[model samples]
Target: MELLQLQYFLTVARLEHVTEAARSLHVTQSSLSKTIQRLEDDLGVPLFDRIGRKLRLNEFGNSFLRRAERALFELEQGKQEINDLSSPEHGTLKLAVTTASSLPNILREFRKKRPNLQFHVQMLNMQEMITLLHRGEVDFCLSSPSIYGDDINTQVVCIDPVLVAVPKGHPLAERDSISLLELRDEWFVGVKKGYGARDLVDSICESAGFTPKYVYEGDEPARLSSLVEAQIGIAFIPSTAKNSNEHIHYLKVEDHDLVREIALLSHKSRYISRAALEFRDVVVEYFGEMA
Candidate 1:
């Protein structure tokens, strides 16, 4: 089947609604439906189940969807590879990262070094980053505690100590160090699950024989700091998730502390593009010295 047809089928399968898929792809619903029908006829297997005008992938459709998605992803990556080879320094560099305090410095240095380089640096959650990398949407990813994939290669780059963020006038702010048990029962603004910092908090709190009162989550971890400053909560943020707000204070954890292992990830078998390699070197050099 044609690549376009495969794409259409994939979208319809994901959304489970031809109309919604058409809207997302900026096409007429009729045209999209016809395309899927054509694909099903050519394949001699029905790809979707129609239920009251809504569409969902059938058993065969589910299987086809996975293979089709992988094919499309490889095709796109091949195109990007060709483009990269034709103009090594000019093609786009798609990178993904989780929210970390060191993110700013890396962004700054990358921009400063290659001002003209095209880049799409996505700030995604850990699971999202893994999904994107596996799907070939991103060439590489950076995360904490190192995410593992079947074909992925990873290397630890930095060590992130768990730190407590409190309001400026809060009691813990005045202390140089605090224990996990001392903060038990306190309200906390949590990071999304699977994030390095969030895992650390979860582990530490569990060890203290108490669960935290989490009020918020997601990539914009600074919201937690804002909540802390407002006296709404406290957080066990990573050293990278800095307390940029002057109204908040950060205290180092004493003993029985948690630490996040920052890592760089890429598909093990994928050919390394020159630009990607260069960027990787930049990252390695920067974090290596810091460590």
Candidate 2:
């Protein structure tokens, strides 16, 4: 029933391990357990099912968790509102992005406008970015292969064309554009399975009647271009990733829908600070001009 107890319960629920949650919350295991027990006692139902050292949320806990999260989110928003009102230029902007290629330009512009504003940025996969946005952990998320949810609002900031990157001396490097079918037998170096670019590439290749054969798979999307430059393998590189590297050839994809939408997302119900709103405007305007 107490606020601290609710905080402890939510942490335990999220981590699903008393010891780990305790460590995260900087509280002892016994204290966290007692707090959770108090919450369950007040609710008149057990919240978790225990299996050895692991804890799983039961039906009651699952139902309660949603309300608990909303409650905490509202409280945090109230705090943010007060902070924004008191010091508009000193607040922190929490953001997550799938790629940092275009972000430097956006952040540079934002910083020039509001040099005092702080930033907490993370480069996360699509799923992790969605989870953080849903949990009200981030102020805004810049993602690709745009997500749709009832509680989320998104705007397509930019449609970055995906191009086939090859080494300067490669056979296809001289072509103006190439089709996916032509690359059926070519070895590729691509981002890993869960990445937005990888998903788009795989889906397009599948539709073209073949699976991409990747000779190398890595988590860093930025490195794919370098890998292609080294002639390790060809790769699908976004227009935003087009750098001044003379050793790489970025050929357009011919007769295919090879593009990713960079989206700006925010929680529909979460409070947006003035700084966050300004940054969002900057991102929209920056990309809009580019388009």
Candidate 3:
């Protein structure tokens, strides 16, 4: 029932290995085990199913985890709220982003206005970002293609057009625009499958009757343009990430609504600090200027 026990349990559940969790928690393995045992004794239920050295959260554990996470989230929010109330001018802004290409400029502009504010930003995949949103772990999530949920508030801050990038000497570069079908046969450089832009492009291409043949797949969307410039492969590059490289040509996706909706996401029931509100305003304004 204690917060420390709950914290240790959550860590163990996430890692699924007591020794590793103990290491992460910076405690002795025996102490961690004893704490977990004490927690189980209080609950009168086995939270985990043990398999050798690893632990799998059981149904009881899963059920308890949800409530535990919410309790911790609320407690953390209370702390943040108190801090915000005491000193509204300087507070940490925690954010998760699916795409980081537009983040530098957005953060730079926000920093100019609130130079005293601190930022903690994480570049995560779409699902990870959404999970954090649900957990109330991040103050806001800058997502692509927008996420929807009953307890999540989403607003599209930017609509970045997705374009095909080709080397100047490539045959596709001769055209003003190319259809998704036309690129089906060509090799592509793209972000990995979980990325919002990558998923959007894949969905569109699937609708267009073909899956893109990726010659190179990576986590970084910004590198797609550079890969195309090197003639490694053509790629679907968002306009927001496009570079002014003379060696690369960006082609429009003819007859398709090829765009990524950059969205700001927050938990509907979670407390948002003044810093978060100002950061949201700055994000909206920053993308507004681009649009």
Off-target runs (Cα >4 Å) in candidate 3 are: none
117-174: candidate 2 lDDT, tens digit per residue: 9999998888888889999888999999788899999888999999888899999978
Candidate 1 per-residue lDDT over residues 1-291, each given as its tens digit: 788999888778877887799999999998998998999999999988899659978899989888998788778768877987787767777888875567677767777766767878887777778777777667778877688878788977878787888887777778888877888767787777877567767877788787777777756765776777888888877776675688888888776747878888997756568877877887788788776
Q: TM-score of predicted model 2?
A: 0.97
What C-alpha lDDT does candidate 3 achieve relative to the native structure? 0.90
Total backbone clashes of candidate 1, pairs 3 or more residues apart or in separate chains = 1
- Candidate 2 — which residues are off by over 4 angstroms? none
Q: Whose TM-score is higher: candidate 1's or candidate 2's?
A: 2
For candidate 1, the lDDT comes to 0.79
Note the residue pairs that clash in candidate 1. Answer: 101-240
lDDT of each: 0.79, 0.90, 0.90
